[model samples]
Target: MVGRVLHIFNIFFFLISVFLGSQVQGRSLSVKKPDPDNAAATARWLVAQNSWGVLNTISSDLGGAPFGNVVSFSDGKPGKGKGIPYFYLTTLDPSARYGLKDPRASLTVSEYPLGTCGKIDPENPTCAKLTLTGKFKLVDPKSKEAEFAKTALFSKHSEMKDWPKSHNFQIFKLEIENIFLIDWFGGPKPITSDEYLHPKM
Candidate 1:
């Protein structure tokens, strides 16, 4: 009888934790998979819903080799995403370091995290993926855009507020020049930067 009671208590505790964590993160996407046929909407949904992705840069230390690092970003406050990902990074990290030098980078995100794919392989075309290629420019700390970025980033990732001050973490954004979205088997969808930024979602 005691074992069963403990098991029940454990499950209750887990449920509470999950609820609290989502509230803290403010990133519950509802796994709301939009119609895949709409390329712009699909791409925007992928960027807005997912918070972390692989940020690729040209590595200076590795003789200009292509480098990718897992990083966290946010397009805007919850439910009001602007389709432009903002990142908080310190030069100590290779992605930030290399990206600052070359300014050319790409951020890749997969829809697998939305948990709507079920058992399908992540690489499957039906699962959806997006790549944003452009220059990674640092936001001027004294500018108004920096204030907006701070709000956008912290709303989705609350923990960033408590990071060590000594790290010199700076706000950066992708000046998207090209967008590649593959949500179905036909082929890569051609999406222009303007269309992606101003999608009719």
Candidate 2:
């Protein structure tokens, strides 16, 4: 009977841990969410808080269909985000190959990953979502910006530093042309690329 009770206690503790861990936020949000009314801030915060997102590209393999792949990215170190997501991709992947063929892509991120959504469904408007549509251009590996991007990516994803060099990975950034953000009720928020790069807040 004592052994059975001990086993039950261990199972109970494991279940408690699982429940708590599920509430943990994605990456290092370190900062609280901005006001829902602050479109730029909310969008930037969503980008900075999450480490992985769906990167959409025009896929040749799909006979010119929009292909979305879940990819890891970093805008900057933790809270010091620049709102320009940098991805370390290799030509071995279809997204990278398509980007090389045609430099058009978009990345989408959601607030649900940050655990701030509470119990609400991910599709709810109040949950917040950001989509950045832009040209996907490759960064010159020897440029200063590449160094900054490497630091940003490695800071968030340490394993990237040790990724197989044979993979021929390269850095790429999105040149924001349009922003679609929905944080609350009503239509999508109107935020220009300039406002996103240089928010008053």
Query: What TM-score goes with each of the models?
Result: 0.87, 0.88
Tell me the tens digit of each residue's lDDT in model 2 across 33-77: 899899999999999889999999999988989999989999998
Model 1 local distance difference test score: 0.90
Which ten contiguous residues of candidate 1 have the minimum total lDDT? 22-31
Off by over 4 Å in 2: 1-26
Q: What C-alpha lDDT values do all the predictions have?
A: 0.90, 0.90
Question: Candidate 1: which pairs clash?
Answer: none
